[model samples]
Structures are given as structure tokens and as C-alpha cells.
Target: MATWHRLGLRDELLARVPFSVTLERHQIAVFLHERRFTAISNICNHKGGPLCEGRVRGEFVMCPWHGWEYSVVTGKGPAGYDEEQVPSFAVEERQDGVYVQTPPVMPRKLVKHKPSHLLETHSKTPGAPPRVLGISTTAMDEANPRFSTSDALLEHAMAMARELQTDTQLIKLRTLKFQHCEGNYSKASHACTWPCAITERDPEDQLSAVYEGLVHWADVVIISTPIRWGNASSLYYKLAERLNCVQNQITIHNNMLIKRKVAGFIITGGQDNIQAVAGGMLTFWSELGFVFPPFPFIAHSRGWDAEDMQNNVRQVKASAALREASRELVERAVDFWKMLDQNRAMMDRPMERAGRKANPLVNPEDAIV
Candidate 1:
């Protein structure tokens, strides 16, 4: 049996902007949805997005980082992911305050698997090289006015990588300068050329090189950014656009270089509204042959203070969650690599024999003869 904790008065909760409570040690988010109160782990099962800070629409809580929706009542996320049902507690209203009972123990076989074509699409081979990459584009320099949470996330991720003995690289966007040449090739003849050759040095050109390197060398990537105005910083977006150029190249080559890789995101914002940015970034990464992980790390703070970096409520929570999520990412990366290895190992086996199947390529009578 679990123990119950009395949070506060029901009237006090109703007075708050969003009626919610944070489970101090558990890091869970509890909310009042209509007549019943629902409890969900604050960390998004998909990417570590803070569910408590998210908006509740009906029975679902949409992740503020990437718009990943989860059922508040059941804690079940979208299809195709292994997400355990979030534990819900019994709530009773009293004259003095609201009381919530402890959640029940999770079932051993709670997660259900879904049929997927991902394995079929990947041709099994033997001894395929294992490659995993962690790329951080957050700028930590003093030139930017606002404090960046991306830096902290990167630091935490790097620390976890070291603990797991994972090889990762940190790429700072601010240090690289590049020129962004807008308009078609007709208007801007230097579209295909580097900015350095065109006279002045453009920061965009330098940044493009870094983007190209990341896309080319990474088999699995983790991207982190600071949210600005409900979106990733201009620096990260610009880099995203440049990376699209790699996809363009693949298209030109008839998708020969289409390498499906695993990807994850980490985002931090001032006001905590990160869904828009995370959604856009995830969509962008998906278009480039990347498989998005279920969990995303989204962190926020009310205001920026020199000392706040050390003591900010949101940042501390985010940092701890990100560390755990990064560890999971490392394990998943290893699993992905092992899957590839298994696929390679199976390639040498003889193809399975089956009854003659109809071929759309030839007429039925002609094919048999």
C-alpha cells in the first residue's frame, strides 16, 4: 500500500493559474481535470518534457517541448512507443483542503509493443560498424544577451556520456560564423559558393560546415537548444535549415545516402513554453532520416540571474531529468547499434524458401511457364 500526501486546499488549487501540484521527490505532476484529479510523472515519456507545465486538453496533457500528447488518466502515450501508464492517485476534497492518496504499484507487463516495419526496412547485414554521435549546438559565449540552458544540458549530457563510456562531440554554434544567402540562385549567384570567396566573412558559411560535418559523421544524434519566443534560438534554426541541404544532396543522389538514424532533443526556455520549438525541430530532424526518441528534455526558468543558473527551480529539475534521460539515450543507442549488428549477421544466411508467389512484374500464366 502506498502512502497519501495532503497537498493543499482545493480552493487554493482552483485559484492557481493552472491547477497542478508537483510531487516533490517523485518528480510527478498532479492536476485537477474536471471532477477527478489525475497524476502523471512530470517527465514526458517521449523526451523528458515537463508535463506539469504543459496545457491540459480534455484528458490528455500535451508536452510543452514537442507537443507529444499523453493520457493524464492512464499515462499512455502515442502508439509505437514503450511508455508505461502513469500512476494515478485517489483524491478526496475536505472542508479544510484537498487530499490525494498514493498511487498503486505499476504492473510488471505494463508496456505493450506495436507491430513495426522498421526492422524489415533495414536489411540485415553482419558486423556493421557501430556509430553514435551526440551533437550540441547551444552557444555559451557572453555575446548573447540571454542566458542559455543549452549549455547546461550539454554539460550534463557530456557527463553522462563519460560515465557510460560513450563517444560524443560538443559543437557550439556561436563560435562559428556564416553568411546566410537568401533568394534563389538567380538572385544570389553565390548560393553554391562559400561566403569567404565573395568578399566579407559571413558567419553562416562557417556554421554550415559544422552542420555538414554533424550530418555526415553522426549515426545517432542528440540536439539541444534554448527556446526563444516559443521556438529554438535563431542560431539553432539557421543550422537546421543548413542541415536540410544535406537532404537535398541525398535527393539529388536518388536517396542513396538516406541513413535512418536515432535522434533526441533537449530544450530550455525562459517561460517554459517549449512545445512549438520542439515540434518544429523534431519535424525538421525527421525529414532528414532520423528516428525521434520517445523522451525529450525541456527545461525552463522564470527569470535569468547570475546566481539563478545555480539555484533556478526549473533548471535544477531539468538538469536532473536530463541526466537520467541521457543515460537512457546511451543505452538505447547501444541497443540500436546491436540491432544493426544483428541485421548484418543475418545477411549471410540463405533466404527463406516459400511457395511460389505471384509476381506483379509478369502475367500469371507467363510467370509460371
Candidate 2:
């Protein structure tokens, strides 16, 4: 038995070619192209983006969320991705009005994808020592390297972690080839995804190492960045932007990926504003659910006019106090993590946030507008 539901007048549908109609709990997208009417499932195959809100490019509609494209008429993906498709329906212009057939002419087809390794939320290995991860965000040429004060301190921190008998991993952002954040969140709050939209498309993106270290491997994280023009290093900001996906998980799913973890920072530069730089780092990591220990950061900076770069480098290189402070920062972070781990049950952190709330537009069904 074939069932057809009248959507609206043909002229009204033509005026609103790309629109959604929910018929008996079935949401469908209707389109007008080249004097023809076509209907397809309103939900995108990828991340359930609202297809009706997306823009039609020729015969295909590009998803507003992550730019996934599907044919408006056939609901098939472009070229090589044709096998992946959304459900398509038959639309007819009857004497009374425009009607869309129920149950779709073509069913939705999705490729069976191997889930991202970052999505695996494995419990901490029992009896295993907690891990410490150091991220050096001072960008430089790895092959023809220049000494970075921040990187040096990060090395000191890592050395301290090893001496303290904790597992340690150091990530130098300069050495890794990764893409900058492409601003998927600007498209929509739901557009930014876990594992990141860019990471899913490009396998060679090395930021996955950072994600693995922060989310799954590390109980404590130490971020080191040089002050660049009164701010954290450019590489640090780049990494921070990409990390929006991590923070967005809380806003989208109320899921905290970084619980029971601690974070500290090391900021060093000849230019001033160490406090501002450290403040930025502290605020960002806190939103990611990381707790801070006492004196959570260690920093070194000469006043703004101390632009004698060589002398500044020599000063940091010879500063035993800076090295000791770096070690102490990591120690504090590690101790905090252990303390949190020991009283994990007593702490009883809840996922339901008080001040923060999840995006109401995350669901396509509720985002009909």
C-alpha cells in the first residue's frame, strides 16, 4: 500500500524549495530543481545534520554542519562516495497540492566505519602508574632547531616525571604535521564533533597524539609555551582552537572527557605578560574538566624591552631555579591527580552541569527551523 501526504501548495513549495516537512514523525526534505520536485530524508547520513537547512549546490545539497554532500534528487553522495546515501522519496505535484510518498523510494545507506580510537573511553589500568604528558607548543623547525625556553622547561618537567617513576610522554607540536582548526563550530554547534571533523577526513593529522594523551593516557598534563607578542605561542593557540572539539563534548553531550586529570603550565619568554598567558592556559584546561594544584603554573619573563634575545636564552639556560620550578609544577600536578584518583568515589563528580547546558539545537528533530 502506497501512502502520500500533502505537503503544501506547489507555488509555496517552489518558494521554499529547500524545506523540511515532518509527516507522521517522518522528517523529510523537499527540493525543487530544474522544474522537478524531489524529496529525501531531512537527516544527514553524517552526524544527523539537518539536510533541509543545508544549501543546494546544483543537484546536491551540502550539509551545513560538516559540508557532507548528497544529491537532492537521488540522495547519493558525490562521485566516489556514491555508495553512501540518504533516503530519497518520490514527490508528485497533484491537482490539490504537492505530495511526498511515505517510506521513501530509496532507503538510507551508510558505510560501516571503524570508530575513531580517540572515542574509546577505557578505564585506567588497575595497578598501573598514572601517566604524565608534556605538550611543547613552541613551533620551530625540528631539523634545523632553535632552542626554545618553553621547550627546555618542558623537557625538565618530563625528566622530573620519569624520576618520580611515572609514565611520561612529550609532544612537540613543531615536529608534528597537523592542520589548523577549520572552524567547524562556526557552521553550527553540532558541527564540531569528537575526534574532530578534520581528523576523520585526514588520517595523517598528528593531533590525534595530543587527543590520545590528554583524554585517555595522561592523568596529568603540563603545557609549555613561549610568550609571543604578549600572548601564548601561535602554535599553542592553534592547538587550543582544535581542542574546541574536546570542550564542545561537554556542551553537546554533557560528557566530560578529562575528569580526574590535572594540568599545569610553564610560560617563558623575554617579552612580558607571563601572567596573562598562564591565565589563558589555566582557564582553557579548567573548562576541559582538569583540576589544578597549588601554584599550578611556573613562568619566567623579563620586562617588555628586554629584547636581547641571546642574553635571555642564556639566562634561561643557566637558571637552575626555573628548572626546579618546572619540576615542582609537574610534581604538584601529579600529586593532585593521585589524590583525585584515590578519592574518586568520594568526590563523586556529576555529569549534569549547573551553569552550563547542552545545545538545544543539537538534535535535528528539534531544529526544524
Candidate 3:
């Protein structure tokens, strides 16, 4: 049995909907709805956000940290996710004051998470070759499949990688269903956790495959994206934002999750702006600790006046030189990977950018966001 701790006068709490206070050294949030008072833990179950500081919406409270929801009355999540519940306490009001029963902290359920590829021990065989992965960010709806010139070039690049006897895998972004970045990085730099805070909260997100490939499986990564409005595909940017979680680990934890990884790009668009798109890609990947080869990217663009989309696709499909260039791009990327692999022990750790050492300041999610 637990003892009762007097909170405050009943009238004092009735004025505020969710009156928060410390009782018996435990943070509790008292809520009054339908003329009944209820108490629950003030800490969010997801990331330990201050639940008392969150706003109420109907019967549920939305967490300010990562937007997790829990009912104030039952301490349960929405339908289909009843298992995601918070701790609730028993409360009562006497003639003099309101009080809450402070019980010994109950055992929290341990979440069993799948093993992260970043922590896996890599086992190399006798003279094993480097594995290469090509990711294509060209949007083509499954219902209405269109001939993607960018995807075409990516296929050619990976095909050449296979011919060179390197183990190759191809991933098409259009084929996977993944969520967009929910602006967790804007909350705080440390809030953007590795493996993604979102991915940890919501399982079944397809971005896990990409993470595994980039972190554990591949030595060389070739990314291909089609330009949209003088930029890379929207899917590419969505994946980029999720990948910030990977780099955030480097920024705050100094783990170097992407060590000795080589990256190259293939950009194809009907309109001209390859340099702008490629520049953005290079800067973004470099910040995440990915090294590039000499002439790391290959691009194809007709011109600013190429209004006919059909002719652009037709021309790209028939160009033998473009196909040959894709092969050369893979060969050059592999050459860089081989050179770095020989002296990787000395080259890997030093490649980490200066000032990226482990940060001591703990930046919380609720720090002014």
C-alpha cells in the first residue's frame, strides 16, 4: 500500500484543467474532466517529454516532443494500438484538499527491438569483395508505370557493377512505402536519434531497409535521382531527411556509423540544373561521412528549352554514350573503394569532420521547440 500526498486545494486545481505538481517526489498530472479528477504520470512513454506541458485535445493529450498521443483518463493510445499505454494513478478529493496515492514505481515493460545493423560485427571471408548498392529515387507509380530514364541509367550502373564481380543490389524508392521526416531534428540536434526516433516509435516503416544497406551491408553506394523543378526527386529529399538521424549520431555521439563508405550519383533530367542538384547531394552526403570518388557523379540534361518530354526520354534511351558513361561511373567508384579499403584503418577515423567529437551537452526534445 502507498501513502496519500496532499496536492493542493480542490478549488485551486479546478481552475486549471490539468494541474501538475510534485507529490511524494513523483511528478503527477491531475486532470478534471466530466466532474471527475484523474492523475497520471507526467513523463511521456515515448521519449520522456513533460506530459504536463502538453496540450489536451478532446479525450487525449498530444505529446509536444514527438506528437505521441495518450488518453488522460485511461492512459491508453488510440484504437489498434492499445498496448501503448502510460501509467495512471488513483486520486481522491477530501473536504480539506485533493490527494494522490503514490505507489512504488511499477516495472516498465522492456521493448524488444530488432538488432540494428550498425552494431553487427562484420565477418569477412577469404578475400571477400566489397558489396555495392544502387538506390534509385525516380517516382513512378506502381499502377501507372512509366519508363524512367533516371532508373534506366541506374540499372545500367548496377549491371556494370555486377559485371565487375562485385556483389550488387538495387533499391527503387518508388517501390517502397516510407514516411516523410516529421521535423524531429528541428526540435533538437540530440532529439534526432540514430535509427530515427520515428522508426523506433513506428515499426513497419520501409526506411529500415535503406538504413541496413547503408550502415551494415554496402561498401559502395550509388544513388540515382531524377530532377524535379531544378532539384532532386521529392522522394530523395524525404529519404534525406530521415537519413539525418544517421548523421546526427555522428554529430552528437561521434560513432562514425558510415565508415569507409564510398558514394557516387547519377542525375538525369529533361531540364538543365544538374550542377545545382549534384552540389546539394555532395554536400549533404559529405556531412554524413560519405567519401566521393574522382568525378563522383554523372548527369544527363537536354537543355532549358527541351519541352517535349517524349523526345527527351526517347533520346536518353537510345544514347549509347550515356549507357557507356554509367558503366564508367561504377568502375571509378569501385576503384576509389578498393584504394580506400587497403589503408582503411588509417583513413576511416580521420575522415570524420573536425568538431564532430561526442558532445556533452544534453539537448532535450522540449528545449524551446
Candidate 4:
């Protein structure tokens, strides 16, 4: 038997035609397709894609990753696998808000294993401290023609991150001589093809292993890039391609290398409008499960002219609003890291001893198991 649940208001649906909400024990995704509101589990039965983020077609929710489609009304996959139905809940629209009645069931699996450090009891506990991670891209250094405002924004972001006392990683994409694209659609073949002998000859031009390690170790990352022709510089885009490769590897192993890591964006451009660059980067972050901050600090009127960069730098240094924005971002990064630490702590407990169990498939170690 099913019961009706109050999910949200009708007005809220107007803002997000397709959105998701986590109830007492279920991750429910709501969708508005063909003038009707439908609620289904956020988890995909096949690979656990967030159905809420999927595109709403005429009558189905299309998974963004592999094109898997599910009927909104029935919560069934396109292939008609009778046993593949996702749990559906009864929903109601009242007072311009929507609500859902879910079928009580076991709690959904925790996203990741909590880190052990968070569970330790410390004497003289102080207030929660902020955690920050400064990230720098080396696209501009490579002198790629596509270098744009995003690179400059990333540089400023790194400086701000340093001011916040966060860990920092500077990634120079040109240094990584990695081969193979795996299965990226953008580039059929591997992007880097430099021979090792040549790489050794110009070791300085090689990618930095320390930086890559830091990226894997950091809790939060702030990415900066320059805009070129209303988009990220070519070097940044290439770096994005390599990052996607790493992401794919992590996914295959089921590792949580990127799980719970907060992402912030900094972009700079010649033109005042930065929507195109910011939008593209935001979309990438969202797809990767990154929690993006509310505002993206985009600096405009930046160019190759050292004078222009210096002038913009002066304005940023003088403006109180810029300072406040930096402080806010640092604070948010800290809070996000704390929450992640707590959650990781929960996962560190010995399941049998703590009276809690987890899906072995989703466990960090078991990701490769």
C-alpha cells in the first residue's frame, strides 16, 4: 500500500520543472512532463544516476550519462524490464506547493564512507575551522591561443584561496603526457602524444605530479580559467578533457576521489558578460556532483595587457565587496568540508561493531573490489 506525501508546492515546481528532494528515507525526483507532475526515486536502478538531474523528454526522464530513459508516470525503464521499476510515491499540489507520500522502506545507502578522523573525540574542542583549497591552472603558461578570462579568474581565485589558508594545487596540463582518451566523445583519440625522450628534455614542460596528488587529496577545489571567445581558454578545455578522463577512471573503480568535494569558479573575460563561460563550467561541475557556490566571481575587462590586469587587480584590492565575497566563499568552503568530514567519520566506524552496515559495492575499498 502507498500513502500520499507532501513533496513541495506547485509554485516551487514552476521554478524547477524537474527537481529532487530527499525525504525521511528515500531520494525522490520530481518531474513535470506533459503538464503532469511525477515523482520517482532519484536513484537509477541500473547505475544510480540522479534521475532528478535527467532531462525531461515528452514523457520520460532521460539519464544524462548513457541515454537511459524512464517513463515518468510508471517509473519504469524504457526497455520494459518488469522488475526494474523504481519506487514511485503519491504526490499532491496544494497552496502552490507540492508534497509526496512515500512508501516507508529501508533508508537509502549513505553516499560515501565517513572518514575516521571526524569520529575522534578531542579535548578542548575549538570552533569549527574553515577548509579551503586553492587551485591554479597552467593554461596561460602554455601560451595556448585559446587562453581567455577564465585563466585570470582562476589565478585570482588561487590568491583568494591562499588568503583563506587553504591547501593549494597548481595543475599544469602541459606537463601531463598521459595518453589515451578512453571513451570521450569530444576527442576520439588521445590528446597528448609527446614522446618521453622529448618530455625529459623539457621536464619543466611536463605535468606536475604533486599538483595531481593534491587535487586528489583536497576537500575543496577552486578552479580559475580565462575566457576565450566567450568560452574557456583552449588549455583549460584541454585540462577539462584530462580531468574527465580521471573522473571516468574513478567511476569505473567506484572510488570516491571526487565525492563531496566542493567546487568554486573564477572566470575573467575581455567583455563584461561572462554568462557563457560560467554556464559551461557550472554545468560541468553539476554533472560531477560538485556543490557550486551561489555566486561566481567573474572579472571583466581583462586582457593580455599587463596594465589592464594590474588595473583590475587594483580595483579588486580596493573594493570591499570583493573582500566580502572572498570571505564568504572561504567560510562556505570550510562549512562544506566539515560536513563532509562528519559524514566520512560515520563511514569509518566498524559496521558490525557500530550496528550499522553498508553496501559492499559502494564502499571505498570495494570500489575496486
Return the top candidate by lDDT.
2
Can you write out model 3's per-residue Cα lDDT over 108-204, one digit (the tens) per residue? 2323346555457765674688799999998877898999988899889999999999998888887888898988778667657777866776777
Mark the 10 consecutive residues where model 3 has the least summed lDDT: 104-113
**Whole-structure CA lDDT of model 4:** 0.54
lDDT string, candidate 2, 1-369, tens digits: 569998888888888778888876568988887988999889888888888989887899998888889999998999999998888998888899988998888988988788988887677778798799999999887779999899999999999999999999989888888999999888778788898998898999999989888999999999998998999999999999999999988888766787889999999989899888888888888988888999999999888999899999999999999999999989888888889989989656565456654443455434332
Q: Rate the local accuracy (lDDT) of all candidates.
A: 0.54, 0.87, 0.80, 0.54
| lDDT tens readout by residue for model 1, 1-369 | 566777677666766624445554455567767765666566654335557778788878886644567777667765654365545456667777777665534421245434222112434243444345555565565565444556666566666666666555666767766644332222222122221121122333565345433445455666777766667777777676555444443333223233545677777665555766777877777666566545644445454333444455356455666566656765565566455445645633433324312111211111110
State every prediction's TM-score relative to the real structure: 0.47, 0.92, 0.76, 0.44
Model 3: colliding residue pairs: none
Candidate 1, run of 10 with poorest lDDT: 360-369
Off by over 4 Å in 1: 1-132, 140-147, 181-204, 256-258, 296-314, 317-319, 344-369
Error of 2 at 219 (Å): 0.9
- Every candidate's CA RMSD: 23.8, 2.5, 4.9, 16.9
